[model samples]
Target: MFTLSSEDNTNFTELLKAVHKIGSKTIAKHAQDVDQKARFPVESFAAIKSLNLMSAYVPVKLGGMGLNVEQISKICEVLALYCGSTAMIYSMHKIQVACIVHHCMQVDYFKNYVKKLVSEQRLIASATTEIGTGGDLLSSFCAVKESDGQFTLTKKAPVISYGEAADDLMLTARRNIDAPNSDQVGILLTKEQFQLEPISGWDTLGFRGTCSSGFIVTASASIAQVNPVPFSEILSQTMHPFAHITWASLWSGICTDAIDNARKFVKNSVRRNPDMPPISSIRLAEVTGSLNNMRNNISASIKEYTEMLIIGDSDAFTNFGFSTRINNLKISSSQMLIDIVGKAMMICGISSYRNDSELSLCRHIRDAYGASLMVNNDRILMHNATLVVMHKEAR
Candidate 1:
């Protein structure tokens, strides 16, 4: 039986060592350029490809290294330390991949695709939100058109991160033209199965390497490509909590960089003054404490999620209390990420304000701001508000 646990992470230590090697040298080198140009971090992706980490989280039965959520979250955090865009891109890919492993593997097509990952470094992207839906992922304006085991769909996606560049895209669509907006299915589409027409620009505050521009996604696939289960059930079981853990891992990574810079600045300030501690030292201490909490909360979520996976707790996936906790995890981590990055900038003072300075957080701050708005925490908070009253309190 496959199991994921913090206690079992020793299995992937060497793999992580390899990831760190590439990160410190290659991924770290391109962080500034990737952000400045607002282009895809080709080098980071290449490093991931070279190391074959695209399959790192994939199971050994499928020719992958088969690391679990706890180990994979560590990889996401480590990548964020070098480049937030790279980390975000990696986290999103893993979330999609997790769906295949945890839910879709019973389908022969998804299982074969996993085996193919060993030889083909295919990148996966997701399209869950459509422009016509008013930010509601549960509804879809794009309905799947099907005839004789053939299916096709088109959607004006508000954003498709790394869309044009992805080798495969997993999308959601109404089950059929006549089906209700909420009757949806998830489909696995290869590049040959789809065409993308650019719709909007991607110049943004941060996460530029993601290349998350708007586009018209037209895709066609066979029935085998469609998930055998309902999209809503799959989202609840796999995508939601998986996204939270991976995304929050990256946020913790960004916070790790911020606190490191803040501490370095304070240590230097104390050395220079020799007699008095800097006024900002107190804030540094406070933020450091908060950062610890932030990391702990994220880690605990990953662990809880891992345990949930281990037991194959299908009922737990739909439980309101579990869903609320998962939703709140994303909200809290995103907001705290901005707060920590801002404080780091204050600690670095004038230097961090300047983009050219050694201690500058110009990129970090921009990337941090993108976290809360990525999935929109306000929307999540609103959803939780509707559920909080009904969510049973934990024993």
Candidate 2:
């Protein structure tokens, strides 16, 4: 499904096998507790960090695995089957790595930082969504202030997924005080360089393990910490596609687990009464079909996006049609997860609803809801609507 050298393909296969082992042995054991406590999946991440998977997306030349987005998406899918929060945190970290690898690594400072990240197995967090921005990612309320080759940025973000646990933060802000809010630059700041003031708690409906709370972030860094490429280019070329694809992959994993549980419930019922098939057997079939459709949608997008990235189609990435298509993929995928989970719940009946039942889907359903609200599906639709009105047909 993806192009890779023989050695990399072998390595990718081995890495995937390792992730599956970790998911079942470590992540699955802690999933329920993580959800109940609304805390970070420390044990699952300890297992992940032990394997140094944090740098899985980085290039082999940079002393890392050099896995592509598709490969990484598969890893997220695997992790999510055991624990959605662990999968989400892993995917978000890789998204930041993708942005830097694609856009900022050309600069010596970021290049060295990538190597450092690989060596240290450092976790990176994102701070793109800010307060008073109405969840608008392109604009920033904070600006980077520079002085004598040093710079400081103060940003109040509504949520920084797993921020407290991260070793570094990949943040976005206005280029300077005089620049427009949309003229933003991406910056990398280590824990030593930034101070975080917790403004809100992380008690949420789903994705509780993410620890995504509001924070007032004040960061100081060398001017060299800023990426040379503009945030808009980075957003279009790497961040948008990487984030949507990985996120969709993880959601599919969560839904797949729920379906599996529902299937198990049906099988158990059939064993008890061989005379007639359980009514939910039909629902299991229906949801399975929907699951396939959801997976195929995600696979097709991964293939298309991977091909464009391989060929370095920067213009295509930024095009209105491409952006709309990616945004729609997110919207559809998010809705499909909710639909799949709801159906699975219906199939398992009270068993799925009861938190004590082994076939329970309460956790999966809650996590599925996070899909639509994370970025808000309506916001994407409205943005695409504007793009559609402005997009011109190619002759």
Candidate 3:
């Protein structure tokens, strides 16, 4: 049964232990370097793969441990506490696996691939978001054309996490040739067949290590075979909630880390001066409390959202409600993290601002701010939520 509480639960305990072993020190040491150079965290991915963490979402039927969303969320939180970019990349791969499992009825090749991923410890990454389409992931500027029972695609993905290094890419593209607003989207995988066309446009302020560079794909390359049914499902349902929960979990971890650093700094200051400012101490406590509150709220939201998804009502309105809640949580968590980090910076003074601190409160503040802006912007999401409510009320 592979119970989490059981001492002999090798998969559960080992997964946690592997995350700590692979992520803790290496992420702390290289996070700044990766951010500064805007390089992908290759070593972190290597470590994660070594622990078979990348295959966590592959179902038990497919020979994977098949952990649930809550378990995966915990693992993500642990990793994000060390490095946000690494966590984001890793989460995306997991989402890819979940998408594959949920959508396909024929499991022969999919199960084989899952077993191979676990045995070989290979990583898969999503190559979805594009430059021209903005955040409308459903409509990709990329398109797939079929000839002689084979498919080829021409794509220009703007931000593919682990784009340069992944073993395989699960990409989305429009299939219809004539219709501009085609609902027939195809999800395809490309092995080592494609080349990374030179992309000179990857300078970002935060989560720099994401290596979120753009690439152009030509039709000459052979597209790896993919099952479109699961792929499309991934785009609509699995990807969105997975993204929300993963990012929210990361933000929660970062918030906790910031609170811990702030507490340590305050304690040190008080030790140095028998009478540190009373207001400083009070503010630290308040920030800590606020962070805790945000964590609880996000955790609860994730639980509720997951339950809704598992209940499996395919009503369009129900899906919107789930997505709206997820979006709100992301916004709320980002704000809380910003507040905590900003206060910590004030408390820790110029030292926290310096690049040498293991905590890197300044970098986190910037990263958190950027995350809040990406995909569905917090302000826009709030507006959408209001409209949804209004539409429901009128009905």
- Most TM-score-accurate candidate: 2
Q: Which stretches of candidate 3 lie over 4 Å from their true place?
A: 1-14, 105-108, 178-182, 219-224, 230-232, 273-278, 316-318, 376-395
> Regarding TM-score, does 2 or 3 come out ahead?
2
What's the TM-score of every candidate structure? 0.95, 0.96, 0.87
How would you encode candidate 1's per-residue C-alpha lDDT over 211-287 as one tens digit per residue?
99999998888988887678887788778998998899888899989889888999998999989989989989999
Write down the worst ten-residue block by lDDT for model 2: 1-10
Clashes of each: 0, 0, 0
Candidate 1 vs candidate 3, lDDT winner: 1
lDDT of 2 by residue, 81-133 (tens): 99999999999999999888888867899999998998899999989989999
Query: In candidate 1, residue 286 scores what lDDT?
Result: 92
Give the alpha carbon lDDT tens digit for every residue of 1-395 in model 3: 01112112346876787787777767766777888888988778778776777777666666666777777888888888888888877777787777766654354556566677888877776777666875676676656676666667767777676677778777776653553533445453545556667454668878777777778755433333545453345554677777777787887777777777877887777888876564578888888888778878767876775665566654431355555666667777777777778887787777778777754587778777767666747564755667577444223
Pairs clashing in candidate 1?
none
lDDT of each: 0.87, 0.90, 0.69
Residue 80, candidate 1: Cα error in Å is: 0.5
Ranking by lDDT: 2, 1, 3
Q: Which residue pairs does candidate 2 place in steric collision?
A: none
Model 3 Cα shift for residue 346 (angstroms):
1.6
